[model samples]
Target: MASSLHIDLHKISKFVNLSIPALFVVFLSAGHFVSFYFHFFTVAFLFMVIANFFYMTVQKEHVILKNFGLMGQARYIIESIGPEMRQYLFASDTEERPFNREERSEVYRKAKNIDSASSFGSQQNFDPSEIKIRHTMFPTPKEALQPFKITYGEERGLEFAYTITRPIMISAMSYGALGTNAVRSLARGAKLANIPMNTGEGGYPEYHLMEDCDLIFQIGTAKFGVRTDDGLLDDTKLAEIASKPQIRMIEIKFSQGAKPGKGGLLPKEKITDEIAKLRGIKKGADVVSPPYHPECDTVEKTVAFIKRVQNVSGLPTGFKICLGKVSEFEVLVEEMKRQDVYPDFITVDGAEGGTGAAPKAFLDGVGLPLLVGLASIQDCLKRHGIRNKMKLNASGKLISPRAQLVAFALGADAIYSARGFMLSLGCIQALQCGNNTCPIGITTHDPELQKGLVIESRAPRIANYVHNIEHDLEELLRATGCKSFSELTEENLYIPSDTVLGNYRLNSPEVQAAAS
Candidate 1:
């Protein structure tokens, strides 16, 4: 009898799990005679006990509920908040994905105009497969590094041949994707920094033009701002939008890195009346853009559409793409050559570059990464003898000066950073971008949340971010013994021999010829 009464440690969980439901049942049985003051509490407790008892004994769907009863619910609650727990407490500085604590801290420091120097050596693993920049014995003086400038539409000679002095520009992020304050803040920052900002294909540039900054109006697959009733590009609307003095260039987005084949998605919960009106969409349904433009079903048609937009808008026009098939891109270049027509610029979006929400499969397994895609696109254009015809802009996870320099060495003429600018705007990386409940107000439309993002304070941060990047870029260029970005070449970069990228670089015709 004594042995039977002893508690077995191994069965403690099972005992507790059964005891909890039994206690609730007993408490509820005694609640019938409770006084009037305890009536409300008794009813609430009775409901909870009954529901849990039903789940434990009757519900066959969840085995945990059947075995552990109310205790099983705690497991679900903990699991639901697991991501937040890992992000804030469990994960180390470099263990997080998308952007780690160390990377985000660097951006925040630069944005705040504070010294971002690190005391210790890099926390990075310094794996043999990693890429490194080759510094020269003879470093160039800072004065020797000339100011960088890239002129769009220089080859075509458009009426507005936009020249950007700085290589870093704000990437496309639609007003609908962001709040009014966020957009205006970015515009003011762009004005302060004397840089261009892309109006992410959000139908209208109303908020983007608030501060009189240079604007690159993006025409997405849906043709939001310049679409006809039939969902095709409207020349009249396109001309009207292009007529705005702030509009300097036009980018036709073929695809972004987040979801290569999948189109843009805006949750219905985020669709406000203003957003619905601006996008010409209904309020109740999720907004899913067409995977491809209806008018651009083939490569030839795509080129023709580009020409049409350029002709109508009379602006420097280009296209943004997340490179998927090399063969398809080779065909596209061929078509451009055959037609004797080329875009003013080409924005190569890497698979790793997505500031918007997207499906897990598409985000994880889709287009080529920036380094590989940019190199391939540059190689293809060079092979076709049209490398000089269009400016090449690269966008991915390039938030720092070193990363930007690597892109230049690989063939990027300019750099666009969406997440970098986002961080500068005080994003906490809550990973709640898809939901409408962004605590920081950068991505949320909620007025209460937006109150946190004061435009006056945030705008300078953006300008500071750009200035700091420019300063560091010049410093890096001087260290590389390069007078200007034009002097950077693939030889200025070194990759470990065992990496796939290294093997490709070593065997490439260009490197082989140079080696010989």
Candidate 2:
């Protein structure tokens, strides 16, 4: 009985599949009798359908096309627009994934210089496992907030040094990784905010210097901006970059949060003549920076290189890294102690960091998230008795006041944010950055897309966004009985005891071994 029913169903399915083509044929024949235009369109459409049908049936590669015929193609169309559908139409504001609607909306509002306050009640679940800020019974007096600052590498036995006036600075987003207009807007914004902007692995571009903003020149493994013909650090190039009065500090790229071990990867399509000239590399191909610095393979060499760059540039220099093995950091600090040298600061990137492009495995599984990485790095630095010698910068989704405050509580002296600033520049989080077609021009080099971003206009939005964050941070500080950021500590932030710290098993003995 089941077999007969199955046969009947199969026959019906075949008839339905065959009926579609039969109907098209009927339409084609009817159209021929009706009008020339009708007939022509029918003929063209029929040919396309027939070709698709033939390909579907004859091609054995895709089982869906072979088994389900023409209807199977619908799946591909739907899959292509799945992310868009989910992002714009279906997903709720609170649903957390890659920067939920709420997060994006907050940035958007702030960037637009609109009110970010929500009325009625809180959207967050006040669950025990959730993180909570410690509010004192006696709050500090609320007053007009002032722009905050943190000085590093100043009077620290360096010929030239830096005093970062803003607690938040722009994180590394390279010239090749971002469009010229985007870089210009960010530079302008940084100037407006009186903050510094870090140029990523890609060489520094002139647009970054156009606004007279302080710049932190980053030396990636590829050493693009300051590299010699042989791809080694060129003293002349270093001096040239240092000579730029706007260039304030230097950062040695070890690893970012997005792809800890996988170095910078700029798609071939993004490589333009300007980018090539700036980076001193040939254009028209993807640029994959090496995973590790050639000049500093070991901790000792890394420390020596930092000192060398500091000496040469006569500026504050530091290294950026995503937390990997705790022992590696410990070893690095040990080397720093032995050499009596250290980078002016260390940027600890959380695994949640954004990237222009990265492999899925590296993006999701490679390094520790911001809080854990920040804690571990802080612990390691303190353990080696060198935490006070250098400032610690934290990145990776440290966009919100709560996140930033938490970071300070965890021992971050300053914060760096990429996606947050991108949002300010009108990034809708399309996640198409890896490709050359970022819809809003935040990551694209295409002239047409870039035209949508006007530097003079978007720069203000970036400043507004930064101002909003700082303002909110001041409020939080006042409520927490802290007169200033310097008074913040881990005791000011609280996480539930039962909270599970992802797959790291952070509470486990092995993971917490380095924790103080």
For candidate 2, write residues 1-516 as lDDT tens digits. Answer: 466435554465466578767767777777877755666667766775775678566688988667766666777899989888888788888895788888888889989989988999877766777777899997877663444677778538665667876678999998877888999999999999888998887785577888889899999888988887667788788988988899889898899889988866656765668778888877777766779888888778888988889888888888999988987888888888899998889999999999888889999999988887887787777777788788899999987888898888778889899889999999888878978799898798889999999998999998998889888888888888887787788678776666534333456444577685
lDDT winner among the candidates? 1
Q: How accurate is candidate 2 locally (lDDT)?
A: 0.82
lDDT of each: 0.88, 0.82
Model 1's C-alpha root-mean-square deviation from the true structure amounts to 3.8
Which ranges of candidate 2 are over 4 A from the true structure?
Answer: 1-13, 24-45, 143-147, 155-159, 264-271, 283-288, 500-516
- Error (Å) of candidate 2 at residue 261 is 1.3
**In terms of TM-score, which candidate is strongest?**
1
